[model samples]
Target: MPSRKPSASLLDSSQDDPSPEDALALAEQAEAEAEEAEAVAAAARARARAIRLRNQAAARELLAGNDTEAETSSAESTVTEQAEPTETAGAEDADEAEEKEEEATARRRRLHIPRLFWKVLASCLAIIAICALLGASGFMIWKHGQADHRRQLTAEFTAAARQSVVTLMSLDFNHVQDDVKNILDNSTGDFKKDFEAQQNDFIKLAQQSKVVTESTVNAAAVDTMSDDNAVVLIAATTRVTNTAGAQQQPRSWRVAVSLTREGGQIKLAKVEFVP
Candidate 1:
């Protein structure tokens, strides 16, 4: 019969049912697609891993460079700080050395002044000593000369007094004129004038009395002596033989003799007898 318009269910069931070859081919296609998808996913994962590894390596390199820069900066700062201290020490040392040199120079200058002053003082003292020595020597020479002159004056006065006493007391009446002349020659000043005024009388008396006298000086001493005048004390004993004396009689006489220097010669100025 119209074969019945074939039932829809059958037709549909036939369409749903696949052939063996077709089923096999589909299974193969599905498996192939799955395999392709698996391959693509694996490729993507490999690419992402490679990219991450590259980024990590780049970051490590940047960090190493920064550490190196920091270390270099620290080292430079340390070196600079150390160098600053060394420079300051060197400057201080130089200043100390200069100060010491100045102090030494000042000490030398002070020492030099004292040495010069001592030398000048020593020279002055030496000059003063020499002058003092010369003055002392001159004084000694003057004193000795004065002592010698005084001694000579004393000797002269003594000798002159002795001679005058002997000559005046000793006389020879036979040569009365000559004896008188001798007395006159030795006499000067007041003694010479008085004796000359009585010269004739003395001659007459000596002749009439026939007087012969001998005299000796017992002692003579200088009482006062000066440059131009002197006084002498003369003690003498005289033996007289005359008309009034009967025989030879001894008489003691003490006479004060005054003398004056005339042109370096001692002459009698006066003769006085003392009781």
Candidate 2:
């Protein structure tokens, strides 16, 4: 029997089927392409990562440089600020020193004095000193003269007091008018007026009573004395001859006398007996 003719469909199917070797070759080619594609993709990723890292490094370096520049600028500004006051203070000190030097120079320049004016001023001062000394000497002399005058006045007052006391206390009845007149001459003020008014009566009483009196001053002292007034304490003893008998008595008296000087003579202004 002859082999049956293969079917057309079977023939076509057999022609369409690949051999195993060819299939293996095709699979190997596909694997090679896939590996190449994967390698290319990995290279692209690596390049991107390296570029990113480089960019980041550059950015960090830029920031660091900026920070360093900023710090350096800040330091420079601080140094400038610190130096400014020192420079200003030095300038001010220099100006002050120059001003003080100028003032000293001006003072030295202004120190000139004229010799003539200085001599004149000194002469005037010496004249004034001499005048003052002369005036003081004159005043001292005047004081001494016044003291001598006061002593003279005191002596005169003491003599007058003794004389007046002796004249007043001693009285004689036979010469009553003369005795009263003598008392009137030595006495002044109220004592003079009162004695003058009672003169006639005193004379009559003395003539009738036949009274005779003699007084002697024992001691007298001036208590207070001034230029115009004096107080004197006088102690005396009196002998009285009356119709009954003759008696001697001791008496104490105080007298205030006021004097006025007129035409270089001291006259009594007031006289009083103090109890």
Candidate 3:
């Protein structure tokens, strides 16, 4: 048997049936899309309104200049001034632009540290230079005084050198005991160890140390110094007792003695011998 031809009713039912439910669903979908679109449009308008307010504030700040004090006071007090929609949208743009510029200027000022550092550095260097000059002057004065003292000491020693040294054969006194001492000194005069032997004789005499009429430096002949040490003698003379030890003999000598200075004090160094 031939299949029944597709009836008009069957064909109509296959087109998902012309039902009210489908129409209702389409209506609900259209309403939801309309609500979403309206929300999005409202958001866009809100953002535009915000931009407009900011630009208006910038415009006012620019055009206002230093207007009347009362006008400025009123503008500051009027909170509604910003909330009120401007007739022109320029106020919103101006506010945001000025805010960015002011922030940039503040950032520039904060980052520029080199100028302040240079100013402080210059002041410090000036102070250091002044201190150095003062220190140098003080040092120079100290050095000059020290040099003067050294030169004076050298001069004194040079003048005293000739008188502190005398012939080994000669004794400052002429007593019998001193006579024998003189003979012994003369015997060692030409001795091979003349310098050492003379010192030994003087040391023996110094041990006995008889005042022997008071002996003074007669002459000094040598100048000796080691590093900072110096020697000098100023004056010399000789006197001696005779056979009875009562009579006196006198001799005059221009003399200087070796003196060493340590820590600014003059010390007896050596008896200078004159040639």
Candidate 4:
């Protein structure tokens, strides 16, 4: 038998089949191309991101500049508005203070006193001082006059007491009745009643004894005095004589006599002997 002739399809298939080494080379080349394409795409994306970041930075800078300008304008306008009002208020306060000072000065000038008015005030003060001095002098003179009058009254009382005490001690038996009568006349009140009641006995005793007494008042003083009454103290010495003639030693006597104004005369109301 003769070998069959190969068909066109088989011939073509066998020719198209690659060798192992060629297939390996083709796979390596394809992988290299794919890696290069991927690298190109990554580079494109990186460029786009860089462009976006730059634009954002520029936009923020522009916005910040605009805000700063607006704020500066507004602050300048506010400062200008406030400055005008503050300056005007300061000027007005200064004017008002100056006007008040001027008014106070004018008021002081209006209330000023005149020289003549001061002179008249001084004259009135001098006159008042003179009047006060004269009044003081007059009061002193009146006080002295009152003292003199009291002294005169004391002397008068003392004289009356001395005279009355002397009268009482001087008694003679022969003139007993007359002496008793004189005693009764000089006295009033309890003294007069007591002596009158005992007068009869006193007269009888003197006549029987032939008694005679002469009295001398040594000293007299007004102890107490009022408008209508006075008390007087008297120191007296008496000489007594009987049938024996006269006593060698005179008897000393102290008496207190109370006198009252009766019928415009100072008369003894009571008498007491003092030890």
Candidate 5:
């Protein structure tokens, strides 16, 4: 009794089938692979959700920035429009005030200038008239003073000339020394020198001739006058009584006498007979 031989299909199936331990290991490995695949899918989904949230947040921030910029621009434009009209109105008001002030100043100047000018003119005229009056009064005083001074000079010169002529011509033989001394005292310069040189001869002649003379100055006038010197023209008469005359004889004479100031006294400098 031989057992029946196994079919080929069955034998192959049995050889291909794993053992229980191998099947269990294979099933465990498959389960582990499935679990690992599920974990990888979950990681991928989490990364995609995070990326979408970040993209949405970025879009919201961009929209907010753009809205803020638009609002700022609109506000700036409104402020510029309002400020421009206000500044223009203020400038027009300033110009109107300045023009009104200038017109008022011009009207005040026109109203007051003529009165001020006439007052200044009258003051100047009064000053000028006062100066003219003072000047005329001073001139008149100076003129009168000068006339008085000239008259005093003429009188002094005339008196000196008359006295000099009288002293020169009057002589007496009885008082010959006194007569010569008087002549010398009243004279100076060339007359004194020349008369002194011929004094002895004149004295001798006067004594020998027994002369007595008397003189009178009829008139004396100053011809040319200065501060310290003067020339005078004199009309004089001399009465002579000598040995050859029975009575006194009168002689008319014209003399030009030059006078000088000597030691505060006027003296005769020179004398010339006028023919």
Candidate 6:
């Protein structure tokens, strides 16, 4: 085939498809896309490189430290971000855990009662026991007081009887003085020696003065008495006749007497004469 020049019409048609400005703009666009792709590839490579560097730094820190520090670094420590908050997160976590535990502990502690309750219970019981004991003691004291009053009444009655008996002895039984003396020598005697002696003395005195009569006994009631371990005291009053020589007049004389117990029976101790 012979070399020939291309037709200008085909050249013109092809030229019409793309102007110079359009071609230049397309070239510029392609170059900008290429530059953007190169920038993205570089960014990805840098990110990968940074990740590798961080991992290496962590491993190095772990290796360089002791067992405790290595564990700390291996767990969460990083060369870049290590200084930022190593203890803050752990301490915060610990604080939160401690706070929760303390709250739980407080709740548990509230359910337990103190020893003071038992002590209070014991004290109350002791107080009640003491009150009961005191009440019993008071009752006993009241009972004893009543018994003492009864004993005092008995003593008064016995004193009256003893005095009455002594007064009786001084009456018309002037002839009975020797009989009383003999009775004193016998254990089976109705009266004790001091009692008989006292009676006998009064009888002898009454007969000597001749103021006695048989009606002396009939004019009165006599005798009620008691004794203590050591002694007895008594009181009495009496009426006796004073006679004139012709039996024409009989005047009455009043007498009072006190007696005391000696050797287990009442003895004449004193007398008061009343006219």
Which prediction has more favorable lDDT, 1 or 3?
A: 1
Question: Sorted on TM-score, highest at the top, how do the candidates line up?
Answer: 1, 5, 4, 2, 6, 3
Maximum-TM-score candidate:
1
Better-scoring candidate (lDDT), 3 or 4: 4
Error of 2 at 120 (Å): 3.9
Q: lDDT per residue, candidate 3, 1-275, as tens digits?
A: 12233346434655865578766765676677677778888887898688656645644874448567676556544523544444433444654676788899988897777778888999999999999999999999999988887667666555434322333323543253454444343332233245445655665664465435445554443345544455553345566654445745676654334454445544334443443
Tell me the lDDT of model 3 at 90. 44
* Cα lDDT listed for each candidate: 0.78, 0.68, 0.54, 0.76, 0.80, 0.52
RMSD versus native structure for model 2: 25.1
Q: lDDT per residue, candidate 2, 174-249, as tens digits?
A: 8988998988876666767888899999999889978888888776677667775565556666678876786657
lDDT of 4 at 85: 54
For model 5 the local lDDT of residue 247 reads 61
Compare candidates 2 and 6 on lDDT and give the better one: 2
> 1 or 2, which is superior by TM-score?
1
lDDT of 4 by residue, 1-275 (tens): 12234345434655778678866766776677677767877887778557545544443453345556665455434433533455435434644676698899987776665556788899999999999999999999999998887787787777778878887889999999999998999899988999999999999998998988989999888899876788999999998988776575799999998888788777778889999
Worst 10 residues of 1 by lDDT: 1-10
Candidate 5 local lDDT, 118-213, one digit each (tens): 999999999999999999999999999999999988888899999999989998888887888888998999999999899899889889889889
Model 6 segments more than 4 A misplaced: 1-94, 103-139, 142-170, 174-205, 213-227, 230-235, 243-275
What's the count of clashing pairs in each model shown? 0, 0, 34, 0, 0, 3
Q: List residue ranges in candidate 1 displaced over 4 A.
A: 1-96, 243-249
What TM-score fits each model? 0.62, 0.49, 0.35, 0.56, 0.59, 0.38
